[model samples]
Target: MAMERANLLNMAKLSIKGLIESALSFGRTLDSDYPPLQQFFVVMEHCLKHGLKVKKSFLGFNKSLWGPLELVEKLCPEAAEISASVRDLPGLKTPLGRARAWLRLALMQKRLADYLRLLITRKDLLSDFYENSALMLEEEGAVIVGLLVGLNVIDANLCVKGEDLDSQLTQGDVSVERDTYKQSRQGLDEMYNEVRRQLKEECQLRQDVENELVVQVSMKQEMELAMKLLEKDIHEKQDTLIGLRQQLDEVKAINVEMYQKMQVQTHTHRHIIQQLEMDLKIEREWRQTLQNDLHRERDSVAQLSTEALQINGLKKEFHRLQDENVQLKTICEDQEKALEELGSKLSESKLKIEDIKEANKALQGGQVWLKDKEATHCKLCEKEFSISRRKHHCRNCGEIFCNSCSDNELPLPASPKPVRVCDTCHALLLQRCSSNPT
Candidate 1:
């Protein structure tokens, strides 16, 4: 049952699509003789017959498509026209013949899909003629009805009255027709879309041009009005200029008389000005001489003031120098006293050195004792002696040195306790004791 519905659905789709394309190509009009139109009717008849229930009547097992198609009139009032017309036909005796005639009339009215769609909605009424699985009673029936919507655009002008409606022509090569139909439909759609786009662009361009032209026209009108106003003002100014030129002529005549009078006065004034210029020249010479004397006096006064300032500055400098000399004399006197005290200490140090040398000769042979003033630097390190660097007497050698050079202590035969000695003297005494075994 499902397979039957599938086949019928596929057939309905191809036939309805190709028929709509060919109808559009033929300017939406088809006659009974057109091959695609005849094939569309045959496919629709097969779809209606598939899964149809058998009705036992006086004629035995009647399964005519006309029964369900007639139910369209009861479902919708608008189908009454096709119903009455089909019934009134002269020679449509068989239900199949009447059904075929009715389809043509309904298609001409452009309501074949509408009438069938209404009949399919009422399954209870359709059950009398079709089985539960009939294409008319299932979803396939509703789909085929929907595909008929495209056929509404076509005006099918069929005169089936004189023709035989009971017999139908077999379908032709629908697959090839379907492919050709697709290519043509695609090209037509593309051409229509391009034309619609170009038309829209042209409309926009025309609207822009019209708006610009309107603005230009309005500007031209404004310039014309302004030009007229400027010309009117120029005429008024030209009329006033004529009167101004007449008045100028009168003023020129009065100026000529005044120029003659000024000429006479100019000569008399020229002689008086010459005499006054001579007097001014003498006055200017005398004034220049007086200015020279004033300048010389001012220079003399400035020279005297400068000399006085110089003398005052020199006097201040001399007083400052005298005060500095007095202070320097006092410092010199203090330095002289310090030098005398150093001389006395030097003499006392010489006497002590003479006594120490005598004692060194009385004892074992030894080097001469160094006086305090004679040893200005340490003998070992050669550092200059200052007040902080005091002299030290070496017990073994009796030589004067800084405390740092004579810091070592060692026991000596002359002293019980350890005595300070120079680093050289300490080493010499230790070597002597180690060798002599006394």
Candidate 2:
């Protein structure tokens, strides 16, 4: 589980990093090709490459080139105004727009190429100038190829003619053959077709990358959700444990009280048994005294009848004392039986307490807090939290929500008083109370 979580986190980090790098790289490319509406051209290229819908403002050459053409717009405001009509031209969003942008880019490249060729033709009049112009032309051609390559419009290797031209120009070629120009043009057309092919391939690749990222993100979310559920389960179990601990303490107190009562009952029973023994001892002494008195009376001549009657009464009294002793024995037996039942009940209570302890032990281990407990958005309304819109947690469900969604304070079975809850829980609680009426 730990390894899986780590892998998921790593994948997310890499994905985010890749997106940041791509954006930064694109920004750098635009910055390097600044001045003379380079950024505008680049933006168009980017939109075309990604097949992205261009902003309506982008259709206007002046508006789209606002940064680079700022001076022109300010000095030649009328010209700028007239050029704003160019914005009504097609954009990359439609086929016509895309064709327009492509045509314009192609025309600009062709014009630059022609001017470079003219400079090459006038090499005799400008020897050193010729070399510099040729260099400039080579650089420009390379830049054009780079633009197409960056936009996935052409292959990196398709700039062979640009390299060959740079090599020939470096060797100080005074003249160029018509066949060489044709070859260069052929190379440019091949590069164009390659650009189209690469663009098509890039489109498919972009879709695949988007789908893969989406799937990965979705899987990450599912894993996170599973983790949250596990954590919630753990917290609930911990709460149950806490409750059981409280109950166990209460049971222990009750058991102590019951044990004290049992002790007192046993002590009382012992005192009663001692009193019965003392009574039996005194009765034995009285019977002995009665027997002596009967003997003395029998020794006297005329009191024989009285002594005999007294002897009979003594016997009857002795028999009655024996019956009382038997009744006391029966009462002691009943008391012992009661004590046995009380002991059994105490044992049962102990057993119950042990069972409760075992249950508490069973609930000993689980995580109470989620790893991503502070959600980015409200669970109920699905609104993202901002500086003014703070996240709030529902006390009952432990889910995050906006204040408006979880504003109600309601009583729950788990709480001692009314506490904050979400709308659904509040309604459910109300319905339950109404149904049960207790």
Candidate 3:
């Protein structure tokens, strides 16, 4: 309807004009929390959403300005970054949130006007999302875009990731802004209503004054009463004014409290981000160290293979040890990936932390498995464990031995399958088994 266009155009003018004027007065970089800037975005959202076609899918009907905004990226290469940033922004779950954020980001980049201009020019593309009479499809859209050009002078720094964009719009429309601001400003709206009521009373008083002129003779007596009533009404109005002032003070106090809370929240978010970054860095360094350990282990394996003669019997154990080292390398690769994932998954970071601690403990040394460095030769045979004659562990005694000495397999209580045991332990177990006659 003509009325819709007219109203939207007027509001667009008001929002743009108001924002520019206020932002210039702001003197500093306008942040995401600026009031007039927020209102401007709300107005732009309304303009974009006007007469948007509802597309139905599995999730029910869907309407979002983001789809149209996405077209801007295709149309103009400069907008691609903004669109990508919006897509990657955290805490924004809905398409609408993305759309809202896209608008803010575009404004921050000072290309919002240019992007909108491109969009409006491509009516052929916008037609799918918006009706012909929609604000975006009409001259009103162009006018709004032109007005946005003035906003280029203003700078905005928005932390899109920190904000709860998906959390807005549940309470009401743009008439009220952010929820916290809305809660404080609710009293202001009540004050506005009181002012309107006061204006209506004044208008009624003027009408009565006009009627009194016609009945001057009878009005003489009624005028005294009317004057007395007017004086009483003035006192009541003054009392209302004082109450309004008190309410205004309360709202101002609430706003200050909310602002302080927001500052605290922002500081906390920065602290958390810094902590995560440090954690990520530490994880990366740990991963690098693990990679180094893997390389050294591989070098030791290579040296062992070069030294050992591949006898048919020794080849099997050699292959098994080779396969075990391969698994170790694979496990290290998987762990590297898990460490890389810690940056994005802060909640599950503690899982990787414990693993890191265990690795650190092992590096310092553990009591269970005899470290390879502790013994250069087989314990029982006194044969020097060379690179090819690789040292192996007897599962029962946790002592180092050459493959030939530890190759005998016997079932251990801890293991369901037969596992490697030293010759001495193997003999002791067999003798004990024969004596028990089980």
Candidate 4:
């Protein structure tokens, strides 16, 4: 029971170590900078520490030493008897007590295998610590395997010796340690070498994996930088395009403004041309009227000079008659009276001629006024004729009007003098007269 308990404790210890080593190995396989891998390592470390404590507590338990005794008895009661007999044998107590230790060793082996499997299943156990531990585990496994093999050989020999003892009641005739020990030693050396070689190969593989990961990380960084540069370039190009578009818009606006100014100038030029043509026509008409007035004035001046000459001749004849009267004044009294009456009559005739000349001058002034009125009427007619329709021309006042305002019969107010009624005024007067009975 003690042997079995020791074996169980050793198995638990190995199992815990193997689990920790496997977890560490998984951690190394992940990206070294991965935060989750770090967290996993922390959990593994905690679990390992807990396992160690459990192992220690288990080893300290009194029941743990004898826990497997019942199981052994159930499997083989003869084994218990053999154990007792070995304990009583001279110089064989220690060997027999230790013989059952194989059970613990086997358990340790299974635990180690389980621990390795745990490491293999995990995704983050590729650290240097894990690799080194794995190598150590491999070496340890080889040693454990050798021990197990020797134990198996020893158990077989014990089985044969027990059979002999049962048959012949003899206990000193069976011997198998020499050949078993030789075979175990040879197997241990070969396994050790193989374990060392495997360790070296695993180290090389781990290094290669780490290098590949680093190269991949660097390539990813370079790709990110390139993308950033491309994005920046695209943004710059967009800005340039926007600037150019704005410039194009400005140019278009300038062109539109220029086109509008040109149109306005064209309109102004046309208006000025029409205005100038109208002014030229008005100036020509004014010049022709002025020429006609000058000719009339010249004719009137010549007529006045001729009339003055004829009046001078008449005055000379009157003076000569008066001198003849004075010569005959002493000749006869009746003749003197006649001469005086003649002289008085001559003075009266001269005064009448002067009145006639004044009357003619007033008549000429009235004729000029009438001519001016006629000219104004003609100008009004021309103005009406220039329009599309013939407008009304007031015969009494010479005022122009449209066709609708040409009613001439209606009289204006008496206080205002002559009534020059348009169509509206004529209608208003008729309306008022109809309303008033008188």
Using all chains and alpha carbons, the TM-scores for the candidates as numbered come to 0.39, 0.17, 0.40, 0.20
Clashes of 3: 3
What are the runs in model 1 whose C-alpha is more than 4 Å off? Answer: 167-438
Model 2 TM-score on a 0 to 1 scale: 0.17
Q: Output candidate 4 Cα RMSD.
A: 28.1
Candidate 2 lDDT over residue span 1-438, tens digit each: 333333222332333233234545545422212221222232233222221222344445211212212222344343344234334443223333323333243333333223223333443533322233232223332333333322332111111122222121222222222323343355556667998999999999999999999999999999999999999999999999999999999999999999999999999999999999999999999888777766655555346577789999999999999999999899989899788878967887677656644543443333132223458888888987654467776765667788789999975545558899889767866775565422
Give the Cα lDDT of each candidate: 0.79, 0.50, 0.80, 0.45
- Candidate 1 Cα deviation (angstroms), residue 184: 20
* Candidate 4 or 1, higher lDDT: 1
**10 residues in a row with least lDDT, candidate 3:** 179-188
Report lDDT (Cα) of residue 182, candidate 3. 54
Badly placed stretches (over 4 Å) of model 4 are 1-67, 71-175, 223-438
Using TM-score as the measure, which candidate wins?
Answer: 3
Q: Residue-wise lDDT of candidate 3 within 101-187, one digit each (tens)?
A: 888888888888999999999999999999878988888888888988998999889877525677756444444456324533454
lDDT of 1 by residue, 211-304 (tens): 9889989998998998899899889888888888877877887788878888888987898899899999998998887787668667867986
Clash pairs of candidate 3? 304-387, 304-388, 308-388
lDDT score for residue 399 of model 1 = 80
lDDT of 4 by residue, 1-438 (tens): 333333333343343343345546554332323332222222222222221111234336211212222233334443454335434544322221233332222232333233333333432332322333332223333333333232121111112122222232122211222322343345556667997999999999889989998998999899899999989999999999999999999999999999999999999999999999999999989878777766765675687578678878878987998888787665677677777878977788677656644643453353312233233223322433322234455433445664445645643332235555555445655675566433
Best by lDDT: 3
lDDT assessment of candidate 1? 0.79
Error of 4 at 70 (Å): 3.0
